[model samples]
Target: MRKVIGIGETVLDIIFKDNQPVGAVPGGSVFNAMISLGRCGVASTMLTDTGRDRIGDQVVSFLSDNGVCADYVQRFAHGQSPVSLAFLDEANNAQYMFYRDCKVDRQDINIPDLHADDIVLIGSYYALDPAVRQQVVALLDQARAAGAIIYYDINFRPSHRTDVMKVTPNLLDNLDYADIVRGSVDDFEVLYRKQDPETIYKAEISFYCKRFICTRGAQPAVVLADGGVVGEYPVDTTDTVSTIGAGDNFNAGFIYGLLRQGITRDHLDRGLTQQQWDGLIADALAFAAESCKSIYNYISVDFGNNKQLPNHI
Candidate 1:
């Protein structure tokens, strides 16, 4: 089996409601997806940095317990692990406040060898950070050269919106390297000032990557692929406990479809048929919907274990 390799930040998220701390969970954009994928028995590994502190210890243990390899994680002795406070509102949407003790970089550990069938998934500010971008780009370049699919998720938040000009080049560069790109309506609006997801896909993203997924919360996601245009599965909006990791798990499920379909890296941009894309997007919708129903950052056991994912999705 070809392994999935992910590189990103790892942080502990303390969730709050009504100004009081409710729960804390270890999470990051790519971290959440990789964990969910590992739980589903995918061969996965994460490359990230964390402080050599108790929180960092727990983060490492969490990865190991979930079947995600922590061998590539770097531990810095000078700082404490990063943390985020996510405040949930009446709609269960999160507004976040983060804290991190920035530390000097250490040489990254050796990346795992990639096979033609492998997939490399990465995104968020970690991939775009100046200090880390070179290493990340090198990994993506190597993966692409080896015929491994590179998936990029633009999970840009409001905090970065003001720095659009500064990060636009990096964002486009990352897009240029990916075989598939996924982003939400807000991500594009903040970066491209385009609120229409389909327009963002066709006008901005499709020029770089042939496959684009544009997600509109509650509304149908749009899939623009080589074969044709396909609208995504419509999810029923139910009560959500917290919306922290829904998108990350959606990425995981879409990746699951790719793996389950036996898609290889070389065939990434050209392989899937319309029907295949539909099925894949459906799986992603189910995963995202399942996540919205819980306080946890990923799909619950009942949904994860159900063989009815396709039908329900």
Candidate 2:
């Protein structure tokens, strides 16, 4: 069976609203997307690290409950699991503060077996961190050899701005390995000081990857310069309860669309038809909007139960 593999960090998100504690959920960039895929009954597995403590137990349990395979997670004995405190504002967007043990590398991540047409998701500072670069690259190389489609999400935040010069090479390397690259407007602003999706794509993203997608919060997502295709796809607007997993679930929906539409490694090189792009982006918009309507980092259980989309692959 085809599967989706994700490599990233895992954090317990302690949410606060108006300075008061609200809820806590397991979250990370790729981790959030994998969870959503699992909820949708997509074959999903995660490669991450957590402490061998109660928080680690909770994290593993959450993954299993949501249907993600947690066998590849490395439970370290030396440090505590990471945690983040997210404070939501009036607009329902969050400002985050994280707590973690500073470490050089996590070495024991067993790369999951990859097969042709499988999808591998990777992003965030985890993709650029020098400490774990070797392990990440090992998996990337395996996926490449197996003809898996690698999807890169440049989930760069302002917190990583100081390392821009240092990690530019790693960023470019990831772009080179990626079959599809997605980034938010905020991510681009921090990387290139550019706001317009078209400008950023033409200047920064095109040389490394042929497919680039740029998203703006509540604004139409730009499918920029992808195999001579350029269009603005509008978002599904809704009264957002939280914007935590909007982007992550957008990714989940996109991958789900690929599986359902039978898009494979073969189709990526030949380029997708206009109709295929429509199906992918529509699923992306709908999943993102659905995730925004709730506080959970992944799509609500209710949404997954009624999603009705079948994974043909």
- Best candidate (score: TM-score): 2
RMSD of each: 3.2, 1.3
The segments of candidate 2 whose C-alpha lies over 4 angstroms from its true place after superposition are 103-105, 227-229, 308-312
**Could you say which candidate leads in lDDT?**
2
Q: Give the clashing pairs for model 2.
A: none
lDDT of 1 at 44: 88
Q: Write the per-residue lDDT of candidate 1 for residues 1-313, one digit (tens) a residue.
A: 7778998988999989898998888999999888887777778899998888889999999999887999989888787889998999988889988897766555556688887868899988887887787779878888988888898999998887677788788988999999999999888888878978667777898788888888888778888776357666676767778888889988998988888776665566456777778778877877777777767787765555553223211
Number of residue pairs clashing in candidate 2, backbone atoms closer than 3 angstroms, sequence gap of 3 or more or interchain: 0
The worst-scoring run of ten residues by lDDT in candidate 1 lies at: 304-313
Model 1 has a clash total of 0
Q: How does each model score on lDDT?
A: 0.82, 0.89
